[model samples]
Target: MPYRHLFKALQWGLILFCLCFAMVGGTMAERLLELLQCQPHANPALRSCAWLPNALGLRLAPFLSAGGISDYPFVLLQNFWALIAVWMVALIATHRAARNAASTAALPDRGKTRYPGITGADAGRWASRAAFWVLLLGLAGFCMAFGTPILGNRVALEVLGALGCSPGTFDPFSSPCMSAPGFWTHRLAVYVIPLAGPLLAPVWLFMAFWDILLAWTLLTAAAYILQDHLSKRARRPAP
Candidate 1:
């Protein structure tokens, strides 16, 4: 419990950081999509599209562009969510570990004696199983989120390619293209590419989610260490 206040402050700070980053990334992503679909000369509603891309370009120039310059915000948003998920798992693991340790320590005879019917070992084993399931489910959810966009992108691209439309040359959002075959496929790609492309990029994956996972591991380890120290202290004989 030493530096508990500091730890809490740091946790809140990280949450705030993630929230702000996600918000900014989401906004940028929306704007980037708008810019891509905008035809300012042809559409009166898209006049702001001219300045928005320029502004985003200026802001994002210094940062690493994953997949492409336009895909950076989506990558950032993906990593932000990944970080949040990892934090949730870490918190659950830490809480379960600490609670089990405390329960074991509180049992008679240094957790060796059974109270009534349930023993400390039983409690620890149950906690361990619960933690394992929680971790497994969290990992499954992460993988699903990570892969969904990629799968969608691939299917969309395949559809477009089969219809003889080149994604690079096709303008799916244009009025003329509205009647084109595979229009929906192109539409899907437009949405999926922002998410899928960056995730597929090894450099971006390393730059973003890898760091988040590493931080989660370190924080969880630190929490367990602290919990173990407290449990050991409680187990010592009173002077």
Candidate 2:
């Protein structure tokens, strides 16, 4: 394929990312297991598990502190990997489209050529649609993050109530609802306040904008590659 080098690069990048993710996850898991092994009546010094931190490296102390691993780093890493995966898929689709266009161009009668794979126009259109939806979702999240506070806690409480969580018993800092079995409710409880509050709102907004920009960039690149491939194919004489 014309994008063979680019595809290999992406594969190596993904491998590196996975290795890093595994290291982080394994270290965190080991630390958690050590804490769980400590007896309730054990001495404070013995239960402290100082050696675990040392083994994991001093630089990770902040993340390993407070009896748990930080979720932010893991979330960021997962999202980054997801973005890379999407980009790789887009590149593969673009390459396939280019190949199909070339094959189509080889026929003496272009009108009679039956394209067996995705066409350049189709790939570009799908990429554009994906970009639009990503932007729309990002904007919606941005609005929700900023508007939740203005909407007040009543709306939040109502939603929580519908989820079988008691509004009167709900405590944002130490709520069991935050770690509920259901994914949507758990995420709602854990992130709604942080996203709406002054402390993390700016950070969330920045990440949201970053996501939008990445999606747009990916879409633009795919479109450009497809157009270039189609144009080159058009200029080639039929065999």
TM per candidate comes to 0.30, 0.29
Cα lDDT tens digits for candidate 2, 78-140: 334546667677667656756766666676654555544456756665665565565656556
For each candidate, C-alpha RMSD in Å? 15.7, 14.2
lDDT for each residue of candidate 1 in 34-81, tens digit (9 for 90 to 100)? 566532222213333444343334333323344554654466554355
lDDT of 2 at 16: 68
Worst 10 residues of 1 by lDDT: 39-48
Q: What's the residue-level lDDT of 97 in candidate 2?
A: 57
For candidate 2, the lDDT comes to 0.49
Q: Pick the candidate with the highest TM-score.
A: 1
User: What C-alpha lDDT, on a 0 to 100 scale, does residue 55 get in candidate 2?
Assistant: 32
**Which pairs of residues have clashing backbones in candidate 1?**
none
Each model's lDDT: 0.47, 0.49
